[model samples]
Every structure is written in structure tokens, then in C-alpha cells.
Target: MRAFREDESRRNAPLTAENATRVREAMRGISFAGTPPHWAELIAENNWMDRLHGVGQSSSRS
Candidate 1:
């Protein structure tokens, strides 16, 4: 998403110009090792998942 890329670029802002470009490129190329976890797996692992789920549900209604 554009917003995600923008946020990632902003996070690279503290680095030197070359370092920032490298950081952004590295982040853009992210690939999970092994299979990606499912949403239910995420919910089971994280205590904050309930809070996040509620926020997701609320956002969908709006």
C-alpha cells in the first residue's frame, strides 16, 4: 500500500541518504521464511490480538 510504503520510508529518515535507500529497498523486498502464519495463529499467539481484532471490526463498520 502507498501508506505502508510512506510509513516505511519515514522510518528510514534517521539514516544517512544511502542507508535510507538501502533500508527502504530491503524492507520492500521482505519475504517470510517458511509458511506465513494464519490470522487465527496470530490471534492465538498474541494477547493484543483481541484488542486488534476489536479495532479491525470497528473499522470495518465505518
Candidate 2:
């Protein structure tokens, strides 16, 4: 997760004109799945705390 955050920050950093053009070109062919189709319903039906902290009932256990 830390590595993912670092990579996201690096991707969002300001780019030089040449780099910006290259980045734009690179994104042209990209296709994003954009959150799963059932994401909202799944989230609504599930307990987030359980998902986020496993099956433990307390922070101390985590």
C-alpha cells in the first residue's frame, strides 16, 4: 500500500513539456476498468471494518 501510494504520487508529479506530451500519448491507448461493476452493492452489503481489519473484533488484536 505504501508502494502504491508512492507510485501514485510519482505519476501525479508535475511534468516537463516533453514528458507531459509523452505521458499524454501513453495514456491515449489506456483502458481502465473503473471500479468493479458491483462495487457499490458489494460495499453496501459488507462490513467495512471486517474487511479493513480482518476478522478481529478489536484494534489490539490487529
Candidate 3:
């Protein structure tokens, strides 16, 4: 998770920052076949859902 935040914050470093961006793009709108019920609550509690959807997020890139 720390690595994810690092990549998110360092968009100018293409090699490092692209990892999280690519992963997030791939995972967007994807639901695992057998996801556990508790996972939804946990993700929402941590505000991960917004990250996945890129909601209300800011980017250094214009």
C-alpha cells in the first residue's frame, strides 16, 4: 500500500509511477468472482473504492 501511494505521488517518474496507475486502471470496475462480503465494507472503510474509481482524486499531470 505504501508503494502504491509512492507511485501515485510521483507521477513525473514514469517508471515508478506507471505501476500503480496501470494496476488501478486494470482493476477499475472489476469484481472478483468470489469476493468475500466483508471486503466491500473494508474497502469502503478505507476509501479504497474511490481510489479504484479515481473519484475525487487529483493528479499532477495536466
Per-residue accuracy of model 1 over 3-54 as CA lDDT, tens digit each = 9999999865444556545755887888779865677465554677677565
Clashes of each: 0, 0, 0
What candidate 3 gets wrong by more than 4 Å, as runs, is: 1-15, 32-36, 39-44, 47-62
Clashes in predicted model 2: 0
State TM-scores per candidate: 0.28, 0.32, 0.32
Error of 2 at 53 (Å): 38
In candidate 1, the residue pairs with backbone N, CA or C atoms under 3 Å apart (3 or more residues apart, or in different chains) clash, namely: none
**lDDT score for candidate 3 against the true structure:** 0.58
* Candidate 1 to truth, TM: 0.28
Query: What is the lDDT of every predicted structure here?
Result: 0.63, 0.60, 0.58
Q: Comparing candidate 1 with candidate 2, which one achieves the higher TM-score?
A: 2
Model 2, residue 51: C-alpha shift (Å): 32
For candidate 1, the per-residue lDDT at 58 reads 50
